[model samples]
Target chain A: MTRIVFLGWLKEMAGCAERQVELPSLATPEELIAFVAGDNQSLAEQLAEPSIRMIINKSVLAGKTLPDTIEEVAFMPPLSGG
Target chain B: MIKVQSDIFDPGAELNNFMQGRTDMGAVVSFTGHVRGQNDISALELEHYAEYTETEIGKIEIQAQRRWPGIHTHIIHRYGKMKPGEPIVFVAVCSAHRQDSFRAATFLMDSLKTRAPFWKKEISGDKGVWIEPKASDYAAEKQWTNKV
Candidate 1:
């Protein structure tokens, strides 16, 4: 099972901050996002935003496919830190 | 030193402590960011990924140190709910010359603004609005690469 975390407005849209789920085979960020968003179109639309960032195992996931032994995946909206 | 805390801190005291016993360093530069009390905003709510936020900022601090050797840097950023006018972030750098100290501090702030994982929401009365970084903020960060 992969731990999925959401931040910023995505948290609100997702309705929860975190969850654990089993991913499908060769799950990329797009597939992971689709799986997480499920049938909620609003949440899916928000998650589909281009600026959303994906972090896996404490580092930004730049590649297309998630590693097989992933621990955590975080979906972060654009940062606006001081 | 890097600190990510929910408790309020005295920036002046932090700076004083960071500057203490640094006789070898000729220049010390510091910046403190406060929550703006404007547009009827009552408070700013900052959310951060507990460990990842610090880890990312630590990477930035490391980069700044590597970019400007012989420099001491400190970053203190607050998360959670804070009232307007309350201190939000503080950065300080000490070096043998003013240019490195100043530029390092600026780099830290710019990186913190654009790269750090902290998210901000402006709270005004019953409404809370998530905010994105301004175009100017991206431009400021891009200055490091001469992209602007």
Candidate 2:
């Protein structure tokens, strides 16, 4: 089980802050995106935009593959912080 | 002392507290960031993570002290809803000369704007928009990378 966190408008629209998704160890970012899309249509629509970023741990994650661990996965919109 | 508070601060008291028993400091430079009536299109309501904001500001102060010797710094940032003409943040740096104090104060403000986890919600025409960091702020921060 991996912790999937959301923030900002994503949190407001989904009406949820975080959730645990049970997936295999080698699940990729594409797989995670597909899973989220399958679970929540509103979040899927929001994440469809290119501005949204996927962060594993504190740093941003790029490419298709997921990390070895899913201890912290954050779906953050364009950071509006100063 | 570094503080991130929801309550308003008395500038007189803060200044006095920062300056007490500092006879050797020849110059004290301070910066007060106020909530202007107009932010792009609206008034602002600022919010911040209290613990994280204070910790980050304290780190900035430590970095400033390391860069310049014999400098004292104080930063106070207020969170929660703030109106126009109210103080948002106050940074005071004291040093033996005006140049060091002035530079340190400016550096602190620049770093705070970029690194601090503070957000502003601008209210315009009954709509609230969250303000993001401008390209200008990034441009300013870019100058510091080479210095370090």
Weakest lDDT window of 10 consecutive positions for candidate 1 chain B: B139-148
Error of 2 at B39 (Å): 7.1
Tens digit per residue, CA lDDT, model 1, A1-82: 8898999888898889999988777557777778889998888788777888888888888868787787888988989999
For candidate 2, what TM-score does chain B get against the true chain B?
Answer: 0.90
Q: Give the per-residue lDDT of model 1 (tens digit) for B1-148.
A: 9999999989999999999888999999999999999999999999998879889999989989988999999999999999988999999999999999999999999999999999999999999999888999999888887421
Q: Output DockQ, candidate 1.
A: 0.91
- Output the lDDT of residue A28, model 1: 70
Where in model 2 is the C-alpha error above 4 Å?
A1-10, A16-82, B39-43
Top-scoring candidate (DockQ): 1
TM-score per candidate:
0.96, 0.74
Per-model CA lDDT versus the true structure: 0.90, 0.75
